[model samples]
Target: MNSSRRAQAIAPFHVMDILARARALEAQGRDIIHLEIGEPDFPTPAPVARAAIEAIENGELHYTPALGLPQLREAIAGFYRKRYGVEVPAARIAVTTGASGALLLALGALLDAGDEILMADPGYPCNRHFASFIDARPVAIPVGPDTAFQLTAQLVERHWTENTKAVLLASPSNPTGTLARDEEIRGIAAWCAKRGATLIVDEIYHGLVYEAPPQTALAQAEEIVVINSFSKYFHMTGWRLGWLAAPAGLLGGIERLAQNLFLAPPTPAQFAALAAFSEETAAILEARRQELKARRDFLLPALRELGFGLSVAPQGAFYLYADVSRFSGDSFVFAERLLEQAGVAITPGVDFGAVAPQRHVRFAYTRPLPVLQEAVARIRRFLAERRA
Candidate 1:
């Protein structure tokens, strides 16, 4: 069988591969501490789970409208209004299978073959691959701690080739957990608007911030679309649901594509997600957020003490991207040794991008306090033995 060029161009998700190996080890009775996954360790809020079960009992298991349940769309719109003080109309919201589906529709509709989209090098790989899936090239802009590991207006201006069609950004980004500031996002959005390009912001980790809350990009640029998911802060990873708030002009095309591609997102999941925004659910999620903060506070200093280079600490998300050149020149090799010797699993930066990948690794604090502590202890022992 022949695979398409698009399939070859898209890189495999390395973390999932690492996870599979870790699972293999666990099957052999190994006690592995998993810090490689990106999702929260928290359970779905009881209300949301209860909603799904109730909906099923009531036989609300049919396909939703192609754009999603109208009420769920309205709920998502209302969430932006209440949380970010931004008025997002329900008409502009398109619910899809997940953030993955939303990205597929957005990139597929907006880009033609050979079109270029700019994104941070050390970003969510899936974002870049979505462009490649549509035969659109994703230009990786190398970023560092100075830029908070986000694309800036200057980077956009510098990388604006004739074929550049759009910009993809993720704040409180994966791997680094670093955020793009509001002013910079505004400037970049303005640049894209002036150049007739589009800006797509991934806000899936929006509700998981440790410091101040993030300002919505929707508020920054009217022409931009916002991508968010139930997977991260809402603790609904397996539910595979998310929504996109596209500009009114782009919504029709995105909706039409959604009709053909997905028909609708999962009906039971849609009904359940209605409770995700409730006050009771918010309380449950906030408590878990505090726990994540505590884990970060403990692990950040612990890793530094253990001599991992963390020049700029993370502001959001459950990850800490560290420079491991001091310990090993190759992150993937070091990660394998760490897994085999210490039984602590993590993701190598090669999974994210080619920018200094050999020198970096990402640690996700998706485990509880005790589990994280145990992983740290094991890592400390592994480093000690390596030095000896």
Candidate 2:
């Protein structure tokens, strides 16, 4: 039997495969320090969890309007108003299953079959797959540490072809954890606006920032679509809830796609996420952010001391994309051996892109400080033993 060719064209999630191996090792009673996955080790904030419990008890799980719960949409808008001082009408927000759902809706509404969406390489693997799912091409612009692992206006201009449709970028990006500077995004938005191309910024890691707070694309350009989540900063990974804030001109098509795609996002998750923006929850998340920041600080220097080549400091999110070329020629082999021989798990850069794939690996600082310290000690010993 044959499956969809689209399914065939896409590659497997190599990180997940490594995770499965790690889990198998764990089941066999091996201790694995996981710096591989991007998920926050922290659970959902207590208030948010309680909200889900209450919603479930009340049986308030009915299908919401395809666009999402109006109150939640307003809450998201209100959040922008308070957090970024940007006024966004609730109607322009589409709450979907997750960031992936938001991406699906935006890509569906924006790109034609042959359209090309531009993004930085060494990016989230799912972003390109999301474009592929719609039969649109995702053009990867190779980015290094000089521009902080982000796309510059110049690179975007150089990559623009006749089929180019839009640009998608994530500030506090997944693998690298580097930000697209506010000025850089503004310049990209202006260029895209001039060309009549859409700019979609994935600001999911907004609240998770460690350095200076990142200004939202909505704050910079009123119409550039921004994708966000209750997952990362809110620490609600399993909730499967996120939102897309699009401009009024594109909301109708996005709404239609939302209506048909999944009927609505999980109802209970929406109810639960309502608590995510509250002051009590904010305090809790802030504390977790500090914990993550501490972990990042500890691991950054430790990796460098171990001879890892990292060009830029990760300003936000919980990842460090380190070049492992000094340690081994192939990062996949290095990652696998680290997991198997040293009981440490990290993601190979090949999972992110074809550009200099063998040279890099990403480490997530989602684990607690002590655990990270232990991982470092283990890695230090592993390198010493290998070199000896």
lDDT scores of the candidates, listed in order? 0.91, 0.91
- lDDT string, candidate 1, 1-388, tens digits: 8798767777887778788889999999999999998887788889999999999999999989999999999999999999999999999999888889888998987899999999998988888788877789989999998998999999999999989889999988988999988888999889888878899999988888899887889998898988999988999999999999998999889988988888889999999999999999999999999999999999999999999999898999999999999999999999999998889999999999989999999999999999999999999999999989
Residue pairs whose backbone atoms clash in candidate 2: none
* Candidate 2 residue-wise lDDT, 75-175, digit = tens: 99999999988899999999988898999999999999989999999899999999999989999999998899899888898999888889999998878
Cα lDDT for residue 236, candidate 1: 94
Candidate 1, residue 269: Cα displacement in angstroms equals 0.4
In model 1, where do residues sit more than 4 Å from their true spots?
none
Clashes of each: 0, 0
